[model samples]
Target: MKELVEVLAKALVDHPEEVRVNEVVKDRSIVYELSVAPEDMGKIIGKQGRIAKALRTVVNSAAAKEKKRVTIEIL
Candidate 1:
């Protein structure tokens, strides 16, 4: 799960090397915190948060099979 977020971030940001993903496991749910270069924030989040919404959707669906809730936070 961490890897997936990392890959997605790297692809979206110009500073690929600065992309970072931290995972926090809480009970049956997984939380992912993604940090990218400040200048690349707009690209990752997109206009009106459309990209952010899509990202969360993808992660949630992927974790559905495991019956776990997934949350993504961009920082």
Candidate 2:
């Protein structure tokens, strides 16, 4: 999951080297905090946050089979 978000964010950002993903495990779920270069924020979020929403949806569905909760936070 961490790698997945890292790859996705790196692909969208101008400063791929600045992209970072922090994973936090809590009880039965996982949370991913993704931070990218300030200049690349808009690209990651996209128009009307469509890209962010899609990213979340993809992560959610992928984690469903494992019966675990997953969330993506862009900062």
Candidate 3:
């Protein structure tokens, strides 16, 4: 799950080396915190958060196969 977020963020950001993902596991859900270069934040989020929404959708779909609830936080 961590790798998935990292790969997605790295692909979207100019500063791929600066992309980072932190994972927090809970009994019922998992949280992924995605951090990118400050200048690349807009690319990850897109206009009106469309890209962010898509990213979350992809992650959630993958998590659904594992029967886990997942959340993505862009920072």
Per lDDT, the best of the predicted structures is 3
Over 33-57, each residue of candidate 3 has an lDDT whose tens digit, in order, gives 8988999999999999999999999
The total of clashing pairs for model 3 equals: 0
For each candidate in turn, give its C-alpha RMSD to the true structure in angstroms: 0.9, 1.0, 0.7
Please tell me which model should have the higher lDDT, number 1 or number 3: 3
Query: Clashing pairs in model 3?
Result: none
- My TM-score estimates for the predictions, one after another, are 0.93, 0.91, 0.96
Candidate 2 per-residue lDDT, tens place, 1-75, comes to 788888888888889999999999988789999998888999999999999999888889878877889999897
Off by over 4 Å in 1: none
Tens-digit lDDT track of model 1 for 16-52: 9999899999987889999998899999999999999
Query: Which residue runs does candidate 2 get wrong by more than 4 Å?
Result: none
Ranking by TM-score: 3, 1, 2
